[model samples]
Target: MSNLIQPGETLRVLVFGAHPDDCDVSMGGTVLRYVQAGARVQFVSLTNGNKGHQSILPVALAKRRQDEAEAAAAIFGVEKYTILSHEDCELTADLATRRQVTTLIRAFAPHLVFSPRLCDYHPDHRATAQLIQDASYIVNVPHWCQNAPIRGVTPVIYFVRDSFRYPRELRPDVLVPIDEQLDILLTALCCHESQFFEWLPHDKGIREVPDADHPEERKAFIRKYWLDVRKQYDRNRFFSCLQERFGEAAKAIGHVDAFELSEYGNQPTEEDMEFLFPFPVYRRETWKTTGQRS
Candidate 1:
């Protein structure tokens, strides 16, 4: 069967991340775009995000992060949100975990899978990436995880954008314009207090962090301080890819999401991308109403 999903047919997307808010930070806007197009999106955090907070203990932080994940998932109206019990900074893509990941892929039978690249900074992120890669072929083998039915066709896998100039930089196969619904991403991030409001600021050595408790102030801080930093990375690194995909419109985009095609999953053609990436289905009224869900 062709990987291209028809307009009337609902799209199923499964996203795996190392930490609780990784999916929200990485692809929140793109996920909103999918849900707007009537796609069923599910987010899974491979780790419990226990080690992210400086003051909070591991067990307490893990529980707090789980609550934050549920809140953020509600913001996107995803089909489900799942958090695995793996220890932070200690995740391994061993055979047992690989089998578990394969079962997840087979159970959801996603049309496309979103995963981080094999490396960036975090060990958990790298392990999650390796997990997805290892499960790519096994997702189609019925005997691998006999309880869960096989996906039959391997889902096309895409690595979320990353910037690390070591072995090879990412090649942009898809560029998404998030200017329309950038606020939704921001609103979603507001749910993760420990990461956005506390730890990240301290980690960066920023003396004056936002009063993350206040809603209006928090939103403004996220936009001015955090998202702007991300915008710098995205613009300088991926503007050319945006120009390639979006042409003249790319010049005006304030926020963009970039993705790279993975060699392990089903290879999609240009036409297939039309269906795979639902940027064309975008409507101004569609996303402006996202607040209704929030």
Candidate 2:
């Protein structure tokens, strides 16, 4: 792991998730592309997922989750990983937890931070999002955490997609094409053995994908699972966004994942967008609601 404050170099990104697999499931492709583009990416999990399954022992489950997370990180080429060791299903937006996130923001000084949106059924997910959102804004405030150094600039915050939202207000402002990296995403997700085969079961009970000695059977199993998930997402929207950004080539693509711009600190300018994201094309909604001029 390369740990040094270089004078002028790569962009740093910090991804915070409520559970071990959240980051990988949502932003794994984007993370991989960032790392491949020579940026430093660090993933942090607020909870170790010990209480995720009742049948398994907590200690053993935690250990398995940690190992799986490490393996997934390795797949993404992420250098740094931090697990908060908090009990699963018990996260809160308390001062101490906020400070823990603040400490990391200070340490990494990431240019971009990805977290869950504040609209969710899970308490831990909502709490994690709130904590990260608060820490992102307050990290630069010297009075909040005096010991930690202030961030140079306020980082851009992004919200990951959720399975369901009650109010259904969250909207995507960014859609990154993951067609090339879907295989990697699947492999990374499959690392979490407990979540896939152990805990994930429909109303008809757990449907096990046959993993036989034959490579064809395994590939078919993976393809079926991946295709079903791909069908659930609004590929058309993502493809449109991608086409806007990447032109005709993007239009030819099939599937992609979306991300909503939950919070844009200080309102990034056009130049800033070019410097930070560098996507070729995009459309910005007029800031009419907030009475903020574009």
RMSD of each predicted structure: 7.2, 4.5
Residue 253 in model 2: lDDT: 61
Question: In TM-score terms, which candidate is top?
Answer: 1
lDDT of 2 by residue, 1-294 (tens): 112233475678788898898787767877877776788899999988888774889999999999989998998999877899889999989999999999988888877788888888778888999998778667888888888888575676777766465778546565666667767766776776677546653322647655435445444454465443642364563455666667878655655556666544434444444444543334344232322225
Considering summed lDDT, which 10 consecutive residues are worst modelled in model 2? 284-293
Clashing pairs in 1: none
Question: What alpha-carbon RMSD in Å does predicted model 1 have with respect to the real structure?
Answer: 7.2
**Candidate 1 lDDT tens digits, 49-146:** 89987799999999999999999999998978889999888899999889888878877878899999996898899999999999987777657778
Model 2, residue 67: C-alpha shift (Å): 0.7
Query: Residue 88 deviation, candidate 1, in Å?
Result: 0.9
